[model samples]
Target: MLAAEKSKKTRHVLGISGGKDSAALAIYLKQQGRVPEMEYFFADTGVELPEVYSFVEKLESWLGQPIVRLGSGKDFYHHLEMHEGMLPQATRRWCTQEMKLKPLEKFIGDDEAITYIGIRADEFRDGYLSLKSNVKPCYPFITDGLVRRDIFDILRSTVGIPEYYEWRSRSGCFFCFFQRRDEWVGLSERHPELFQKAMEIEEGVNRRFSNLKKPYTWVRGMSLKELIADAEAIKEKSALRKAREKDPRSWQEILISDRQDDENQACLVCSL
Candidate 1:
C-alpha cells in the first residue's frame, strides 16, 4: 500500500476559501516550508463577495504566489436553470460540487494529491465538497494541535481578517443559503448591490419553482421577498435581541461556550 500510494504521483495542493482558516493554513504551510511547490487554488463561484476577492489578492501577495482561481464554466444562472431553479441549501450543495470541487478535481487530473485541509482542531465536522479519492485531506492544524486561537493569531499576525467579517460571518457566495436571517440584513446594509442581486436570484427561484410540482426558496420558511417585506420588523427584533444579550462579546462568548457541545458544528467546505 505504501509503495502503491507513493507510486501514485503525488501533488501537494491547498484550497483557499477566502476565509480565515484557509488563509492561515496557507501561511502556516509557507512558514513551515513543508511543501515548497504546494499549489494554492481558490474556486470562484462568480457570485462571491468582493471582500473575498480583495482578501485573496492580499493573501496572494503575502505568499508571493498567485493562488489559481477556478471558476464554474457555467454561471450561477445557468446552473440554477439547469437545476430547475432550485437554490442550493445545506442539504443540497450542488453549488460546491459543480463550482468549487469539480474544478479542483479537474486541475489535479489523476494525480494523487495531498489536499491540505484548513479545518482546525476546534472544528469536528467533515467536509462534503470534495470526493476525490486521489485528493486526500491532511489536517496539519489537528496534527499540530492548533485551535481557533491559533487561527485568529495567524490572521491578526498576517493579512488581517477579511473585511466582510464586520457583517457576514462566513465566506462563500454572497447569496449563500447557509446565511442566517441577520446575515441577510447585514448584506442589505453593507453591500446593497449584492443583496439586490441575491434578491433577484431568490425571485427567480420562487418564480421558477412555483410553477414546478413543488416549491422552494433560498431560505427555509420564507422567501427573500417575504423576508424583505418584514425587514424592518426583523431588524428591530434582531436589535432588541442584541440589546438583550447585554453586549457583543458577552453574547458571542455565551453562544461559543454553548455551541462547543458537539452538535452546533458546521461541516461546509469553506467555514472549516
Candidate 2:
C-alpha cells in the first residue's frame, strides 16, 4: 500500500494573548532570531478590551507580519447562548474551551506544529496542555531562564507594554470572571462602556437562568450591580492595601505583584 501521503510541513506558531509575557515572547523570539518562520496568531474573543486590539496591532507592526486572528466566527453572545446562558467561570471555562483553544486547534488542524507558550521561568503555573499529539507546546522563556523582570525589559525595549497594563494585570475578555475586584473597579473607571456591557451580560444571564440552583454572574458572591454600587469603597480599600505594602511600584507593577500574591493562575490561552 502506498504510504499515506506525507503530511504538510511542521508549523511554528506563537499566540499573542496581548499580555506582557506573551507579547514579550514574540519580541524575544524575533530578537533572538529563533523561530524565524514562526506564525503569530491571536484568538479574538470579540469582547476584549479595545487596548488589546491596539496592542496586537502594535506588535504586528513590530513583527512586520500580520498576527492571524482565529476564532469560531461566532461572537461571545452566540457562544453564551450555545452554552445555555451559563456564564463562564474560572472552574467552568467553557468560554476558553469554545472560544480560544478550539479555535487554535482548528487553525493548526492535524499538521505537526510547535505552539510557543510564554510562561516565564519564575512562574510555576502551567499553560494549555493540548491533548493532540501533533500539537506540542514550547516554553521559550522557561528554557532561556527568563523571569518577570526579563519580560518587562523585553517589552520596554520594544513597543512598550500594552496600555491596558496600566490598570489591569491580565489579558482576556473585558468581562473575564477572573478579574479581581480592584481590576473590575479599574474597568469601570477606564472603560465604562465595556464594563456596562459586561454588567448587561451578567444581568441577562441571571434573567435567563433564573430557575437554576445557582445563577451565573461575572463576579462571585455578588452581582455586577452590587459590585459597581460599592466601586468607590473597593477602590478605597485597594488604595489602603497598597499603602500598607510600602513598596514603590507603578500601578502596573503593583497589579502584577498582587497577582503573584494571589497565585491565581488563569487560563493560559487567555493570559499567557
Candidate 3:
C-alpha cells in the first residue's frame, strides 16, 4: 500500500479586520522581521464602512504588499435572501459565518496554515478559531505579552488608528447589529447614504418578516427611524458618559477604554 501523503508547506496568514489590533499585528510582525512569507487578507463584506476601505488601503501601503480581499462573491442582500430575509443579530450572526468565516475557510481550503489572530494579552476573549483540523490559530500579541497600549503604540508609529475610531468603535459592516445606538447615530451623521441604506434594509426586513417573534430592526426595541428621531438624546447620553470619566490619562486612553467596553459583546471574527 502507498503511504499517506502529508502536506509539504505551511501557509502564514493574517486577516486584517481594518481595526487597530489587526493592523497593529501586521505592522508588529513586519517590524519584528518575522513571518516574511506571511499572507495578508481582508474578508470584505462589500458593505463595510468607507473608512474601513481607506484604512485598509493605508495599511496595504505600509505593508508594501497587497492585502488580498476575500469575499463570498455574494453581497449582503443575497445572504439576507438566503436566510429568508431575517436580519442578523448578536445571537443569530449568520452574516459573520456566511460572509466572513466561510469565505476564509474556502480561501485556505484544505491547506495546512497558521492563522494569526490579534486578540491582545489583556483580553480574555478567544477570537475566531476555525474547526478545520489543518488550520491552527496563533496569537502573537498574547505570546509577546502585548496589551492595548502596545497595540496603540504600534499603530501610532505606523499607519495610525483607523479614522472610523473617531465615531464608531469597531470595524465591521456599516449596518452591523453589534453597533451601539450612539454609533448608529454616528453613522447617520458621518455617512448618511450608508445610514439610509441600513434604515431601508431594516424597514424592508420588518415589512417582510412581520411575523418574527421580534422586530427586524437593527437596534433592539426601536426602528432606525425611531433611533434617528432620538439621536440627540443618544448623543447627549454619550457625552454625559464621557463627562463621567473621572480622570482619564489621555484621550487615547479614553478611546481605548471605550472600545474595550464594547468589544466584549462584539463578534470576534468581525470586530477583532
Q: Estimate each model's TM-score.
A: 0.87, 0.93, 0.93
Candidate 3 clashing pairs, residues 3+ apart or interchain: none
Model 2 spans with C-alpha error above 4 angstroms = 1-7, 252-264
Q: For each candidate, what is the lDDT?
A: 0.78, 0.85, 0.88
Ten residues in a row with the worst lDDT in model 1? Answer: 255-264
RMSD of each: 4.0, 2.7, 2.9
User: Which has the greatest TM-score?
Assistant: 3
Stretches of candidate 1 above 4 Å error? 1-9, 128-130, 212-214, 248-267
Error of 2 at 121 (Å): 1.5
lDDT of 1 by residue, 165-202 (tens): 66567788888877778778888888889888888877
The alpha-carbon deviation from the true structure for residue 54 of candidate 2, after best TM-score superposition, in angstroms, is 0.6
Give the best candidate by lDDT.
Answer: 3
Cα lDDT, model 3, residue 1: 31
Q: Write out the backbone clash pairs for model 2.
A: none
